[model samples]
Target: MLVIQIYADNPLRNFNYLIACPSSREALVVDPLDVTRCLAAAKQHGLKITKILNTHEHWDHIDGNEEMRRHTGARLYAHNGAMGVIDHVDVGLYAGDTIAVGQSIKLKVLDTPGHTRSHVCLLANSAVPGLFCGDTLFNAGAGNCHNGGNVDDLYDTFSQQLAKLPDNTKIYPGHDYILTNLKFTLDREPGNRAAEDMLNMLLDHDPHNAYITTMAEERRINSFFRLDSPVIIDKLKSEDPDFSAAPSPRDVFTALRARRNTW
Candidate 1:
């Protein structure tokens, strides 16, 4: 069985995860935001953390990398581009790298660079794929373009890379703001029945930890994932009349992030 844990932290309200394979008693910590909490969880679960996998070098995502590595003596892994930011990385993973987690779990790395040039999302459960999409994708949301982020890059990463994942793949994002993100989606496309329905569900239920969404759900409700929808396209055209005839999904997503940044 695959065991996953999500932890929310300060500043960005980020959600970090730990995925373990029960068969081997080995684990991999993904974008751990808090060192103490991550270590505590490992101990509580009797997990031997053998790897510290980084999605990117953002302060929040990697702040605990150094500490966690020291605690577990696990090998530090990061995309090759993160050499400068990550002090002592042992594994330099790239787009096609496949990492073993315990005896049963294998993560196929997809070099998804939009939030940061080095950002990578781990595609796990290849036999039954799921994504531990750090900041690359989220539940009705995606990462911001603050660090090395670019609108064009975000577009390619989401549309060409992540959006193509099988609809059933469970999306364990870097955070839980589906409700807030859905609200923004509604604002952008008021007549969207799908977004409205999702909004209602989120309203009715508290969207507790159990509410993490699937790829199919995000495809319908996430504005970024619905760039082809007339509602979103119209809004994009209104904002920048000279924009390309077919603006990428990242274009719409970047605009949304900018709007939210000022909110």
Candidate 2:
């Protein structure tokens, strides 16, 4: 069986994941922002940290790589494009590369840029599939295109890459911005009951608790992924008069992202 543990860093709201193969007791740490906390979690699970995988080179994501590597002697992996940005990367990976945790578990890397040009997501291809999407994808929103990130790239990442994942794949984002992102979705798509229902359900849970949402759930609630929805298209057209030229999904997506930036 595949074991996944989520550790949240207080104050920052960053989520770090520890994934392991129970039979082999071998594990990989994903975006460990807090080395001490991650080490403690690994110790609690009695799993050996064989590898450290980074989703992006952002300071918050790769900050603990050096410390974690020093303590665990694990090799660090990051996208090849993040070389200078992530100084401690021992092995630079590409889009189609796969990393083995043990004899049974494997993590497939997807080059999901736009949050940052070098960003990647790790998907666990097992009975219980999970995606460790960094800032590239949030629960109801997508990452901003600031700091060398492009909105068009983010659109493709969502509509092309991430959209291809199985609907049942559990989404484990880098941050817990569900409530806030849902509020933004509600603002844009007020008539969407899926977003409203999800917002209410999430409101009842402890805000600090780690959330694991499925792609099916995201497809319904996430405004960024619903570019073809009539409500979203109407809203975009209403907001921008020039958007009457039979807006493509990309056009609607770009407008949503632009509005989100100021929201």
Candidate 3:
């Protein structure tokens, strides 16, 4: 299995993915916001994109769907719940559905609804695990529930689902917000040496070169994964001293999400 992550030169800083089988060279594309870039990348890799998949119905994630499908004659795959919002979906994907790319790669869909009620993340159990999390999760921060999403559901998805991934699983989110998200980590947990070190590293050279991250590393850097940290709780307490006598992890997660909204 071969996975190529392409950074889209768009205002949203979207990242499109192309996962293919080395032997067959047939690929599956995820959230193609830039059709031309996706096509060019596929061409460079000698890959034929056989399927275009969207994590949800967000415009930026699906903007290139029609054009990509027309260009490659690729079938579109998306969550059935998002069918109402996204057009021309050839396959209605569901939780546990496995979509095969070429002969080796089989992406198993996981129902993750936080960024949107219909959002889904894909898992590729290759030599190294990869999760195409889209807007459901990010490098240092979890996605917001502003657009047709629920924070409680987001909490459940994080605690019940994403947290179970192996420490080595590499998260391939839809957008590049790690630098800013890491800053948010320091804002809440100012004493976090790991986040500080990562923030400084990202400040050097081209930050995109420091993009790849693993779950174990995220445990040290991502604030969302560190809801139990006393420093973060103290920061939140500084704002509302009586918020909770002893805040639960869920409470801390909720408060952090709220603060990030204004950050």
Best by lDDT: 3
lDDT for each residue of candidate 2 in 55-93, tens digit (9 for 90 to 100): 988888888888988898999999999988788689998
Please provide TM-scores, in order, for all candidate models, with all chains considered together.
0.90, 0.95, 0.97
lDDT (0 to 1) per candidate: 0.80, 0.85, 0.90
Off by over 4 Å in 1: 204-210, 239-263
Local accuracy of candidate 3 as per-residue lDDT tens digits, 117-197: 999999998879999999989999999999999999999999999999999999899998998899999999998999989
TM-score pick, better of 1 and 3: 3
Q: State how far residue 122 of model 2 sits from its true place (Å).
A: 1.0
Minimum summed lDDT over a 10-residue window in model 3 is located at 202-211
lDDT of 3: 0.90
Clashing pairs in 1: none
Show how many residue pairs clash in every candidate, following the order shown: 0, 0, 0
